[model samples]
Target: MPTALITGATAGIGAAFARRLAADGFSLVLVSRDETRLAEAAERLKQKYGVAVDVLPADLATDDGLERVEARLREGVDCLVNNAGFGHPGHFLEVPLEDEVRMLKVHCEAVLRFTLAALPGMRARGRGAVINVASVAAFFTRGTYSASKAWVVNFSESTAAEVGDPKIRIMALCPGFVRTEFHQRASMDVSGIPGFLWLQADAVVNEAMRDLALGRTVSIPDPRYKAIVAVGRLIPRGLTHRISAMIGRK
Candidate 1:
């Protein structure tokens, strides 16, 4: 069975990817900050899918954590899912400097390091996939979160071009308003968001997997989001920023 490694594997999109990959017969290595949660998630996946599950507890915000994960990636896995991330509840100006820095470390630095580490192994094997989980926020100007994700999308596309290997796929998976613990954990109020805008994590993962298989360098998982991103691109950046700011006001 192919081995897959997923960061932030205890919940939300990471957990969804774990379930889907497990069902698809991938032996999994799960990484998360919470050791207990990781163990519990591994046990459940193993019981339900009969697939081998290993858990690695590491907080991606630190150097030691990044080095540890990068070391594992260099060891080789058929697939790597860079899914660890979080959101800030306050405006960019209101958020603390350290918080913003931490966001960049996890969203930008860790993704960069993990992908670099994973690719050499994939290149040698000539067959593997790396799915970097970005967000629809990338298209707008919602602060560091969007800015960092935009970097992720651009990085994934540029890396894919540079790699120029059809069998070694690198893609950015962008989802909109996912119904996960993301907002809750960030303490962001979602009353302003419409019910229709919410997306289930499993559905997002399903579309993402399909897009990866189809050789897409960027996967916007839903038709609704695809249209939204298309429209956002056509509108002026100022208007897009205002609209995005209004959507999930605290």
Candidate 2:
């Protein structure tokens, strides 16, 4: 069985990926900051799928935490899902500088470092898949969150191009309004948002995994979101930023 490593595997989309991959017969290495939740998820997967599961509890915002995960990457990972990230739902200036810096570390630095650490082993093995969980916000300037995710989008695209010849696949999985603890954890105000706008975690992950298997470089989970991105690319950046800022204020 192939070994799959997923960061932020305690809840939401990350947890969904864990369960789906386990069901697909992938032995898992699950990473998250919540030790209790990680252990519970590991136990559940082991029991349900009869697959080996390893839990690595580490906060991705700190170098020490990332180093621990980097050590595991050296062992070689068949599928790497860089899914650990969070955002503060407020104007960038109003958010604490410390929190902003930590967000950058967790969302950008950790993903970059882990990908670099894992790539060599995968490349040498001549088979690997990297699935980065970015967001539709990547196309808009929603704040620091969107900026960081944009880095993920570009990184995955560039890396995929560079390594495509070797049959190594790097994909960015972009989803919109995923019904995960994401917004709740970010403390986003969604008072006016309708229920039908949200995509479930499992649905997003299922599509992402399918696209990865098909060697797609970028996987936008929702067709609606894909259309939105397509339209976004056609619009002027100034207009896009204006609309994004208005949306951010909501």
Per lDDT, the best of the predicted structures is: 1
Instruction: Candidate 2: list runs displaced more than 4 Å.
Output: 248-250
lDDT (Cα, 0-100) at 66 in candidate 2: 98
Return the TM-score for each candidate structure.
0.99, 0.96
Clashes of 1: 0
Which clashing pairs does model 2 show? none
The 0-to-1 C-alpha lDDT of every candidate, in the order given, reads 0.94, 0.89
Tens-digit lDDT track of model 1 for 1-250: 9999999999999999999999999999999899999999999999999999988899999999999999888889999999999999978899999999999999999999999999999999899999999999898899999999999999999999999999999999999999888999999999878899899999999999999999999999889999999999998988987887876657
Error of 1 at 142 (Å): 0.6
TM-score of 1: 0.99
Q: Candidate 1: worst 10 consecutive residues by lDDT?
A: 241-250
